[model samples]
Target chain A: SQTIHQWPATLVQPVGSPLSLECTVEGTSNPNLYWYRQAAGRGLQLLFYSVGIGQISSEVPQNLSASRPQDRQFILSSKKLLLSDSGFYLCAWSVLRSEAFFGQGTRLTVV
Target chain B: DQQVKQNSPSLSVQEGRISILNCDYTNSMFDYFLWYKKYPAEGPTFLISISSIKDKNEDGRFTVFLNKSAKHLSLHIVPSQPGDSAVYFCAARRVYGGSQGNLIFGKGTKLSVKP
Candidate 1:
């Protein structure tokens, strides 16, 4: 069974502080990974996606970026956090099928 | 321009009653559509999906209907339960090269099943 894990389930950082959120998948190899942010729980805005290690794609231009250093590891980072950047961040992975399985997610609050 | 649109911001239905959520898209290239259910403080979960070729697909009490000509789709939940209270999102994807390359999502509709 494959499982997705994210760290620091909740975090609070001051504005202008740096940010790093990590995601990893177990029991799967060579899967497509994605990063998403949700505000008000209405809809998810795609932040980034990785097809393979070292290959990352940005969906919505923002103050954030993604890096996939390992086959199952994806990291979302921001050099300087902004107030608008506060939201629920999610990491998801899928293989062959289009339906995605998401991680527990990280609730980030930029004060 | 929003490719997919879920006009309803929220809905309330009595428990055990039927719940219907509607979605419309403007893109014709979208051949595959999906509906996702999201609970508070949790990531959206894949609920149901329907291909353009098919008009309807069902799993237990959850059913998805697609109308290509109208460029619209909907999710229907029979015997709506309190557990079904959550936000519902509609998404579309254009399939090519044997897979959906990317997906476009719409603003979700919050459903409340009153017990």
Candidate 2:
């Protein structure tokens, strides 16, 4: 079975601190990966998506970026966290033309 | 502008009654639509989907209706139960290539099924 893992489940960082959130998938190859962020009581916003290693498409421009270093590893990073950057970050994977499977999600609080 | 829109931010329904959630889209290229259910603090789960070619699709008590001409879609849950309380999101598949694409999601509606 395919599974996605997102680390740190929760994080609290002061404003201007660096941020790194990791997500990985197992039991699949060359799957499409995506990053989404949801504000409290709001809909999700697409952050970035990657179809293959070293290829990324950013949806909403912001203070964040994504990189797929390996086939199944995707990392979301921010050089300096901002107060507006606090939200729930989710990592998802899917096959061609299929529904996505999501990780548990990480809740980041920028204090 | 947001391609997909869900105007209602929240809804309240009594248990054993019916609950309806609505969504609208602006893109005509969207041929496939889906509904996802998300609990608090958890990732959204796939609930149901309907293709543009089909007017409706149903899974048990859950049904999705698509009105392609109006660019609108809706999800209906009959005999709504307490377990049905969650956030419902509407998504449209954006196909970039033959095998590469992703879904564009609406703002989502929070359903409160009260006992």
Which residue pairs in candidate 1 have backbone atoms (N, alpha carbon, C) closer than 3 angstroms, thus clashing?
none
On residues B86-106, what C-alpha lDDT tens digit does candidate 2 reach at each position?
A: 999999986544636688999
DockQ of 1: 0.58
In model 2, how large is the Cα lDDT of residue A106? 94
Which residue pairs of candidate 2 clash? none
- Best prediction by DockQ: 2
Q: How many backbone clashes does candidate 1 have?
A: 0
lDDT per residue (tens digit) for residues A7-111 in model 1: 779999999999999999999999889998888744788889888999999988899989999999999999999999999999988874477888888999999
Model 2 ranges with Cα > 4 A deviation = B96-99
Report the error of model 1 at residue A100, Å. 0.9
Supply the global lDDT for candidate 2: 0.93
